[model samples]
Target: MGRGQLLGREDGAAVFSSRTIAVAPGDDRVELGFRFSGTEVVVPDDARVVTNGAVVFGSVDCGAACAGTGTGPEITVDTSGAFGSVDVRTVTEAAADRADGDDD
Candidate 1:
């Protein structure tokens, strides 16, 4: 048996081990952005519960909302928290191209 090895001589018995990572303050940041059709939303604050580039919650926040650029629908969330999970879905090409690139 090695120093890092687990010894289990019984049935249906198991042992597990894990390592932890420590992050310093202002060391991590999260940016979430999305584009839709003809509108956009961009939040440049690097904090939790941020709105209009302002820090509504959490520390290490931004003073103002980031100015949005470019066309089309979009939403952006800039945060200083960890992103444990995310889910995304988009329309199919057939539905998106129904207007033949024409805006009326």
Candidate 2:
């Protein structure tokens, strides 16, 4: 993937046999069924974690007290048939602007 992008299965599986992959933002919609991953996944730092389960954002060393239904832009981690925790993060203003293609 690109410098600031991450792509993989909901359960964090390799999409291709190659270690290098390239993807860009798109307007496409993807529909799936009971998604589950057996591994940890990485998502955009600014994306919010929306789920009824636990969420670890900002730091991996945090405890259960840090688990929360996150704020900001929504990134649904829970689906109709799946419910679990996710580790997320925050992004710097400059990085967020870059992700939005705002170089100024």
Candidate 3:
């Protein structure tokens, strides 16, 4: 969410505004969808994204192939147990994916 911006909680979900780093509690089976437009999202070394649903990617990480100022906005889905059953990580190319693109 934006700096100090409160998205306000409703039900059991917390929404975050774009353009800043934020962390919120997540369901065990969290669904992750990411679209940076012209920006990039980084997955920290310790981040674990898993699910029992459908997965199109074996794994993905924000490598040099993704360009950023290293301080862009981020949303961290952190949770476990019944609330952290499944997690989805979705990423659509703002630009085209390259066959030679370097990803970590």
In TM-score terms, which candidate is top?
Answer: 2
Query: What digit string (tens of lDDT, one per residue) describes model 2 on residues 1-104?
Result: 11223343554332222121122233111121222322222333334433333323211221221245334344433222232222222334334545889532
Error of 1 at 84 (Å): 15
By TM-score, how accurate is candidate 2? 0.27
Candidate models: Cα lDDT each: 0.24, 0.30, 0.28
**Candidate 3 C-alpha lDDT tens digits along 1-104:** 22221222332232222222222323122233322211123233233432222223222333431243234334333222121122222233312242348231
Weakest lDDT window of 10 consecutive positions for candidate 2? 57-66
Sorting all predicted structures by lDDT, with the top scorer first, yields: 2, 3, 1
Residue 75 shift from truth in candidate 1, angstroms: 1.1
On a 0 to 100 scale, what is the lDDT of residue 41 in model 2? Answer: 26
TM-scores for every candidate against the unseen true structure? 0.16, 0.27, 0.21
Off by over 4 Å in 2: 1-37, 52-72, 79-104
lDDT of 3 at 53: 29
lDDT of candidate model 1 versus the reference: 0.24
- Please give the RMSD to the true structure for each candidate, in Å: 19.9, 11.4, 11.8
